[model samples]
Target: MSDITLPSTPNKLSRYEITGYILIAAGAIVLFWGIIMFDLVTLIATGANEEVGIVFGEFGEFIGGIVGSLWALAGVFLFFATLTYQKREFELQRIELHKTQKIFQQQNFSTLYISFLNKHNDIINSLTAYDINKSEWSGTNFFVFFQEKVLSSFTQKVRTKEESAKTPELLHSFFKDYFIYHFSFYQTSLNPYLKNLSVLIKLIQRYRAETQDAGEYYSFITKAGFTQSELFLIYHVARYQLLVEFHNIDHAFDVFEDLKDELKVDRIVQQELNDENYL
Candidate 1:
């Protein structure tokens, strides 16, 4: 079989190469000056021939002239070297910045995926405790009710899966049908430990991962054993807290903070449930 080929990214100049080039340019300048100085010294030795003292003085003068010329040549090379190297340095800097940004963006997506998995596991744990069998909500009035009550209220913000139908109508229809129909055989029962606050917080987190389309959040809440009343209560609480603290800020910091705090409570609930099951 032929060797598998990998896609290639752009080649950037290495840091070592950049440094080496700079050093070479500096050495060149020094060498250029040395040549000028040596020529001047030779001229002085040959030209001054009267008395030994006068000859020595002329030689010294010649050496001085050579030194001065070398210095000027070195200075000019150093100036151009700085300009050329600076442009290369800037290019390397830009490449590094882009690399850092790409890493951050990838990390952000990974974080979202992990968060969603955690919520999915929590839902499974709650269902297990209640012994509520999952029921298929697809093709039933239950799905219609979910669409009317939940999907209608929530907003959607992301479309990660390209193949999945993602329109407002299709999204509502897909999630409502998927959640209800997928695990329809499980017994429907409420979780004993999860309060409205917990449900609300989980919904908000789900929203962060995707959109809080009314249909999806409500489906998650109900499927996880929360009642419609619980959903409404948490929504109001989140809204009221926002009004009091955020005032008129376009950003929803209160909702985010509340979710962070509620996650703590959910952990406690999970611990208790774990202990009870073990006992």
Candidate 2:
């Protein structure tokens, strides 16, 4: 094999690199100054006639030089160690990114499903500030009121899942009913991100079909205090609402129509993966 030589131009320096260099330079200067001081003390001590003066001067210089040299060494070590750790972390992150990309290519359903989960969580987190800032509601119901009310219910569902989840079946039922009622009236309730929300729901439904291990699905649902069916429904509804808030209708709906062809998997593989972890 031929030698693999690297390119000359490197990436830009980070703030951390700039700081580390500054620290190392300062430490080196201190060490150099300490060495010079120590040498001067040695020479002066040799010339001193009084033994006490020589002893005191030499002792002082010894302490200063030792401290400065240690500080310099520590700075150098820290700089090198930081670089090594950052490189390792970056490589690991890159690997994760590539793996995610591959998964998106091969199993687009799973990719869309994961994106929905993430977006749902993000929207839920964003509403906390709104709750804190708002006071009494006006006689007329506004968008904010509707958002807050829906958000409260959504938050409770999330907390329940985190605390004592049940089977997905029960949770799915509740969400199916709830969304059917709400979505019928407020078709525009999921105003902004409706398209993304719709896509996410379809993706989740696909995941349900792909997932085959009834026991494992039940286990996750039980952990969340919901039946396997119910949890899935609740999750989709929450995610749908969240996406409506975050995206426009066209974009959100577009996700459902993306027509990810690679998601078609063998029944055996799908069953095997269902028995595996949720990831």
- Winning candidate number (TM-score): 1
Tell me the TM-score of model 2. 0.26
For candidate 1, the clash count comes to 16
Candidate 1 on 1-279: residue-level lDDT in tens? Answer: 122233333385444455555555655565566546445456556655455456456545654565445555656655665666677677777767766765685477456545654664455344422112554343123323433333323323223334343444554444434334422333242222223334444544455455323443333433354343333323333333322322322132233323322222233223323446433
Best by lDDT: 2
Clash counts for the predictions, in order = 16, 39
Model 1 scores a C-alpha lDDT of 0.42
Q: Against the true structure, candidate 2 has what lDDT?
A: 0.45
Candidate 2 lDDT at 207 equals 49
CA RMSD per model (angstroms): 18.4, 22.4
Shift in Å, residue 188, candidate 2: 41
lDDT of each: 0.42, 0.45
- The C-alpha stretches of model 1 lying farther than 4 A from their native spots are 1-52, 79-83, 90-94, 117-279
User: Each model's TM-score, in the order given?
Assistant: 0.29, 0.26
